[model samples]
Target: MKIINVHSASLPALLLPLIFSPALFAADEQTIIVTAAPQTLSELDTPAAVSVVDGEEMRHAAPRVNLSESLGAVPGLQVQNRQNYAQDLQLSIRGFGARSTFGVRGLRLYVDGIPATMPDGQGQTSNIDINSVESIDVLRGPFSALYGNSSGGVINVNTQTGQQPGTIEASSYYGSFGSWRYGLKASGAVGDGTQAGDVDYTVSTSRFSTHGYRDRSGAQKNLANAKLGVRIDDASKLTLLFNSVDIKADDAGGLTESEWRDNPQQSPRAEQYHTRKTIKQTQAGLRYDRQLTENDDLSMMLYAGERETTQYQSIPRAPQLNPTHAGGVIELTRHYQGIDTRWTHRGELLVPVTFTTGLDYENMSEQRKGYENFVMNGSTPEYGQKGDLRRNERNLMWNLDPYLQTQWQLTDKLSLDAGVRYSSVWFDSNDRYITPENGNDSGDANYHKWLPAGSLKYAITDAWNVYLSAGRGFETPTINELSYRSDGKSGLNFDLKPSTNDTVEIGSKTRIGNGLLSVALFQTNTDNEIVTDASSGGRTSYKNAGKTRRQGAELSLDQRFAENWRAKAAWTYLDATYRTNVCDDSNCNGNRMPGIARNMGFASLGYEPESGWYAGGDIRYLSDIMANDENTAKAPSWTVVGLNTGYKFNISKVNIDVFGRVDNLFDREYVGSVIVNESNGRYYEPAPGRNYGVGLNVGWTFE
Candidate 1:
């Protein structure tokens, strides 16, 4: 209100240099093990607010690259890297999707369990193959509303499963403004483990290239992944997963703020009309499990996918001669499928309990097309590439859910948890080029919700514990946010609606000595929310803002000093505002809720032992953001640092690891992300000052 009462007393001097800051988690690895809580817990008894990140410590720290490079010590995640791979990474957790400008909304992604989010919750981690990653849990608050719709938290990603004997790795890396990466892997076992029936496998491939540091932002990528497992007797099991990706990029859009203070690597529309992007994706998955007695259990999952996109923006041509806009050379194609089934049970109805029931179905279809990025010249009209054939549609989406869960122990360190889900989403469209300049406006929409969740835990000693939770979440409106219409009517807005939230959290955890500490406090309340009513070029439009508030506090620590040092730290403190009162034209009521970032911190330290040489370092800190929604403009505050060193050898049998890293170090120059209401104010995105990378890995094991 009135610009926060004139900056509300300098906000404790901007939080006093983070009161001695730095934060992200690995405090002596506190018994990691996490499956984003569907069971098998240990992030110290997961009752929400979870964390785990170890994939051989992010494949040798620093830059296995992206996932904001090891999730920056994770506390209420807010990863960013708008180094624009044609707009991809920019995640948000405690500010629920942070006005997404591209991909990922209110979190919920998974890999091994399949479903890299998209039940209308939009998500993309660009094929995720952190070289066959083997961990990265991260679940947060309200039992993640039992994973129904846009859970607002939950990032699974567990890969790397093939027990023993079979390794053939090769890796390479080189970075800094003309980056490079290369990788290849193959993994073990195909029987013999006292086999009743056995099989296991893993395969990976990668290629990344970049010449970008802004300026026409170069890029090239290719990825592949595979997993397979089978052991169908002695109580069944089956698994299979596949992935493929291809990309080609060059977008470099977003500038303003005087083109980022005159040339933040310049792109300035890449010489008009050549903004680019290209993508291709393929996916597959199937999983089944059984152990139907002695405390029953069963599971099933099936997945399928396809995606193809082509983007080229830089509109203009009088917005493609109106005719209801929506064209700038975008040729999309998508096909998706899903099915999940579950059942689990454990005896003793009077005291001990565990039961879960589930059913989920998902579907998507699209063939959306649009042309006219330029090139006509006869009827006269030329600017860039693919022209004519403006807009054609055929969209469809589906969702069905059914869920139930329970967990109760009630004594010897109490426990209780519960869940419920009943989501339903549907959308349809079919325009296929209507005459007289686009009209017939096809449309359809339907959404349903009934999410619920609960939690409780207690344990006074024996390493401490405490918890309390609550949930109810839902978020819809993505089919590219109902495919356009913000006072420029033409189709699909169908009176968009689906935003609900109600969360509550309280937490604690401890295990001092070698370290492990946790703490939480949360609050959420939403009802509609959604904002950002307009954007351009790379289209965006949404509305519905009423009642919203979020509260937060988090802290994490992990330590282990004497055996070769280890340390981690985390901190968060949000207070997303706006509790009612929207008033367009910039009056944002109680402001402070735009692209999040009210204080954040992370720390790191490592020095491996039991090995020849190792080293590590980290630090992150945020604090300033708020690019729109009337907080005027901000972005500022930043801090970054990183370093790494490595050496681990073997020659006779062949195994080697050599690494090097340095990121940002002292070359700071911030603004890593922001674009919240950027209808052309361009809203920052800078990031990239100091950089360097070097890596090598070679392995061979065959048994």
Candidate 2:
């Protein structure tokens, strides 16, 4: 294992050019308002490190199927597609969620002011509707703590609102590996918004199917979303939101190093066990806003959702002999709901100020069951069929948080933003499938934390600003992590403790040549960092390590240089390592953290105009990444290139768009993601080779 010092002599060389270059400075760019900050502030004026991506730009010449397509240029964020839709994407921020084997953790996710993350700190991006998105706000560094638990970072997605002119559109796309997507959208306003009987609505639906790159890896998804706003009176308005998604995917499982070297597309055990997963989810929300007085207002939001999931793993029949072993088939039905009420006052005491306070409450209940994934067929074992029940349990989780935030303008050039949140979470479980061999296994646990964050900003000029921010945050173990004991027991691990950390960051935002440039340096120190203990037979256990440290620097540039030409680039350098000699099986004192890269970069150049032909190309690079805590193996460094070309035109009162794209232009073979600490050494997930796609969209507006 090797270590890279972030403060070496190379630091000055990178920081000097981006700060002192006179040619880079220019007139102010277009202002972008963001809600990720404590108060609604422009991206340039916000005290924290924040970036915004326009939805129209993201879907211009792309598939618009996954976030990995457009989020590669955001500094301090990493999104990886595993080519297997059953497991979802791998997402992390500044090494915060790198340890996760599946799904997203250590970050907060929001869709149109509704919380997409559960109370247990586990989240999934499968429900996001990219085609209807208006903009995405990514907030990083210390100020993220204002969102409460698991706030390593924050991602907020807002969908487009209806306009005065009504429009209907249809779109379709076809790609490699027998992939297809079809979508329809409609948006319009019935009358003027100021009137009592006015209404606005936006609705979208899409279906996607793919024959995946790996063997036996196939998936199909159906999704729908709708938003409607109604004017109730002169002082108040109401908005309704609805979303649903259904998915069925076959799991190919991970491949060992030797297996990947032989055939990257083969699944060794998936054929024998028929591994697969199915999911169905539906959710709705309501939001209301009212004006009470000249300087005060109120806003309230209520949301509820339900989800059901079933999965079959490749666990062998030998494990079923153990009376205490949970079976290979898992079923879960979960119901969740939440509410948020907030009040804002824009009065001044010492200076111009904006004060806001809110209370959030959430609850979830689930029924979990396990069954043997095989049955007897004339004395012979048959796989992929439910045989007998092995485990049954009911679990419940809830959280309550109260928060306060304020922004003050102390002077003309300096401002301050500060906030605090008190969070309390409770967990309870009851086991109902206990037999003589597997005695009663039930438990309860609770956790509490107080998070505080603050930031100060100073403007050097109208186009340049510098800021400093710091905060405290914490993360509690999810229900899945507490399911099995490290010692191969049959009860929840109540001894596991929550991890806590403190982060500090210094950053600068500059307007350069009709574009925006951002640079940031950050560090975080964590106590009781969670880690994998042992994993086998499709089950994983967890334990806490003593201490860890993460430090990094990020630089991003988005410039429109010449007419009809655009350029964008982002670079990240990170040093993450264990600080203590707490041993699981070996001394991992100074080892580099698993599933993290030391360096990552992205750059793209494009020639685009308001109409007619457009073209672009991009390159992405990643350094070697460790696969486990022991640092015995790693994924080699690799780079890939991509190209896209498109055309747009109008004819006979109709709009049309056609586009084509090619990925992995150089046909590079690399590992896309890693399953950390796999007991069977099946850690590598291979990336696809060169692939091609084409899309078409047609729309018409009614007058």
Candidate 3:
């Protein structure tokens, strides 16, 4: 079979009825539906690239500390840990967000119908509680723009719901580098039936601590999550969600090539300056759903939250002498709130059709301040301590968006989906600290866009399908990106404009021999792409580039060979480049975008019998990555392997599970992620060579 060839271009065509055989159908009969798609279509019927990970499967064998451990097998999505929790994880889809040094951009993240991405299109994944997750759905391709700004892709996380008798569970784990985790959870139904007047709830708390593999990178975190559901009546339901997280971590910072080669475990400048961060956040959301009629449904969601963060950087005192520079110590207190309402109606006119309309409003206001990183005595500055305030400002941001979407099944085997959204964003900033040393820097900016998306899917047969899609997406400059100017001027960069992207894709999926195989080809063009103009001493400035282009292909396969054996594989190849001449400290044109690998692949094998034991192994490989727009430095390619095994059993009315896993088993040395365009050439972030973890989970039912 062509599948024997790892890089067969026509493999999708060859994997016909074999993957969807009658024998296989019995094992995979569950109809999988995704919420990110407006139509709630089955995975096989949706005309887009998507993947769903079972949360139970992840918790069994993965570290659960980073989503990458579970999502690495997904094609077209890259997740990397920078070994610094303060910066969050490095995540990108088709190279769209490779330039980001901290947090996540160019994608939309949602948890239980609540938005994680702010109106500014920036998001953090640190608040996610893996223990409470029910499933993770990822959607990619042109149609992603339907989610609004910065929609290179979408990640939707759904938390588990209580059911049946009450249960209490406790889990704990210990791993290499002095890492440990402990968690407790309770879930059950408050009433008898699953219909009206019933109530269900789930609550969980977890604590994680690690000394870290690298010096000065230790961290401790506590997280709590709760969900409550009430069935008001047969036609209406209400759900409430609450989440909180507090974290304290020391930053190891980035390392130069020479520094990494000398000692990957060494901290370049962390201890001397005591660079660290303390962050606390609390959020709550309410969702209401009602069935107005047999064919109509309405849903509304409201959420509010506050986040407080204080960070100390290692910037030298000499840099603080520049009056125009932002200070080394940063403190931000932000309050954010949002509301969303949507209505869906289903009708049949010769065929099935569904229409959805929604309105969303979100706002964020912040009290931001900057102080010297060191104490001052007699005009002399001491590093690593918080000193006098050097800057202070109040920033406000908000967005209002209205959208309409429709899905039409024209025939038995053909479908069409279309949507449009109008988004308006406003920003206002006030300079509250006006000193003789600093200039008056009050500024405001506004951005608006109309995004349209559509897709067509044709089922060639019961087991095969083909699709085509296109969309327009835009990303606005974030508040942090606009806080400074390359010219060393004060105030935000009101002149900065949002970048617009147009994307087109074609894909096909087939079933072959108890397996599902999918392939996609896509291209994207971005105008006024944002690029880092300058970065130094933990400060960054952004400017617009002429244009950029990205083209890529992705392949994924999941096959079950036997009742107890299964295999999965995914591969992606992306060509992301600057389309026009660009200069930033280097010469012109045709450079590969920094921080993204051109080729990446993953493969895994697992065995689980009906009783007794389970085991799995995985391997990940990637090509070299460019470190800067100039492409002068590169991180070499590497491969890593991992293995895990566990046992499950029941005694009386209690259930128990014991598991262990080892990552980077071969002890390969490599850079996990890079700091793009770092001014001081400190671009590499080394990943741990080898690590092991063992965990125990116990649960008991109470009737």
Candidate 4:
């Protein structure tokens, strides 16, 4: 007798029987299906790197549980927690968005077509709840032209819409670092299968707490989300959404090189600062489809949404004082509103020639304030320099884009796809301050630009495809990056030329039995890109790298085989280098771009028993990457492993799942981010050493 074991390249073949088995064809059951996705896994067919996160995988990677940790394995992506509430969460892809010390930039975030990124370039993606997601689409590089303002690719999160039958889920988690979390979800329809149309709704709520791995870094968070669906007919529907999140936490300030080694958790912020922030968002949308004379149909959409956030931040700075890192303050008040409308006609114009044309519009504005030596115990200390006039202002940006796309079947074995978009953006901003560049400009300025982008994809065979596409991408500086000027006036006051890039990609996609393999190679060149010039007078100033290029390859595979086994593996290599120097005399030219690893990948193998038990282990690897323009600061490549497991009930609406993960499983000490640091000595904060955690969940469904 022989026992068999199947993994990465063989699991898909093994899973075929169970997935398509006759046992799943119960006559009384209703089947749920996801949206149709793009074909081809190769780089050539996509002209971009796109990765998917399945809904089932979310259970092991809960929002308040393994949220940031599980995401570590995503290719070309980085996730970091600053331990400071004021500093926004760190998430960057391909070195596109590391400058954000307080908020997100250089990336576009979308959830079912509603923009999660603010118009002024600020974005919030931490709210994405894995439990509510149906699938997550990660589009890397400048390959996504259908979506505008995308400097990097797009992260499209599709949630589980209203369901036909009622379902309920509850989860609880506990782990080291004094962590605990609880979540609940319930969803279903109304009127016991109404006659007019089916209406469905979903609600999700969660709470979490953690004792700091470092002093005063602990945090508590509460969140909730609700969704409603109205069905107009079999071909049309509408959705309404609302979400809220609140957080209270202590701060983890930066540690000195020596202090970090003595105790990585030691920081003035740990004892002197506390922060509280809350965010609320709401959106409504209409989706419709009508068959126009059989082969031609009309599809339209209208969406409107808004989000508001408020935070009070205070920290003691070692500025002009001998001791007592005891007091300083920063307060942020932001509110945003926007809407999008699109209408398209889908049909064959001349037999085998199909196309879609649509228009898009977005607008937004925000209010903010900052101060120095702002004492929380009394009136804000008026300790300041000269010529500081106003403390309040409005910053806004808007864009209008129209596009056309067509797909043609050239022959029996060949087809073609093409699309183009024209976009115009407007900026209306105001700032009051005495600076070196503006001479205390008080009012406002308006700027506008036109951007055009396009792409092409072709199918070479039934099981394989190839694509080649080149598209233009542009990014405007953030509000703070533009209007901010402190003390001696050394901030950006120029019209701030837009950052732009163009890319070309080619690769092959193939599926053999239980194996799905995709590979792509591409090159991206940019001009007027934002980079830090450290040699500036006394501070790091944002300057154009002049020109640069980032080229790379991506390969990923997922397979399920053997009676109870599965595996997933992915690998990526990126090379980003500057093409020109600053001032024409510096050796910065040809320097490697920071935060882009030359080699990175992930591998995981899982197993299940004939009974109700399952477990899996995953490993991640990253190569050394430059952390500064001069290549003086570098973060050595590091690897970490993760482990998780749980179980499910075969019958009944009730099911239980338990899982745990250990970060930096091998205790590899390394700095994850170096935004404001450039020193070579002293390994920055040791990446969490061997973190362990576990979760438990139960779900129910009622008819």
Give, for candidate 3, the lowest lDDT window spanning 10 residues: 1-10
* Candidate 3 lDDT, 553-579, residue by residue in tens: 999998888788989999999999998
Candidate 3 vs 4: which has more lDDT? 3
Stretches of candidate 2 above 4 Å error? 1-41
Per-model lDDT: 0.76, 0.81, 0.80, 0.56
Q: Candidate 4 — what's its lDDT? A: 0.56
Sliding window of 10 residues with minimal summed lDDT for model 4:
6-15
Question: Model 4, stretches more than 4 Å misplaced?
Answer: 1-48, 61-67, 71-74, 80-88, 190-195, 269-328, 349-351, 376-390, 432-440, 443-458, 485-492, 533-541, 583-586, 608-611, 676-686
Candidate 1 residue-wise lDDT at 5? 8
What is the clash tally of candidate 1? 8
* Structural similarity to truth (TM-score) of each candidate: 0.34, 0.94, 0.94, 0.83
Clashing pairs in 4: 11-560, 11-561, 12-514, 12-559, 12-560, 13-514, 14-561, 44-467, 44-507
Report the error of model 2 at residue 28, Å. Answer: 14
Pairs in steric clash, model 1: 22-602, 22-603, 23-569, 23-602, 23-603, 24-73, 27-558, 27-559
Off by over 4 Å in 3: 1-41, 191-193, 377-380
lDDT of 4 by residue, 1-703 (tens): 1111111111111111111111211232201011111111222233345666765665653435433555544566666655544345666676677655445677777665556776545687655665676666666654453455534555666766666678898988887788888899988887542334778787888888888677766777777777676666654555666666666655454454566657776654335434444455555555443434343445444556555554433333334132211113333455554544333333455546544455556777665444444332353333311111224446666766655555455665454545555545555555544334334333333333333333344456656665555556666666555653322242234544557777677766666567667777778788878754431111233555679888888778877788678788888788888898743345878888775678888898889664477888888887886656667766677877777766655466676666666666777665555553332232243345677777877878786
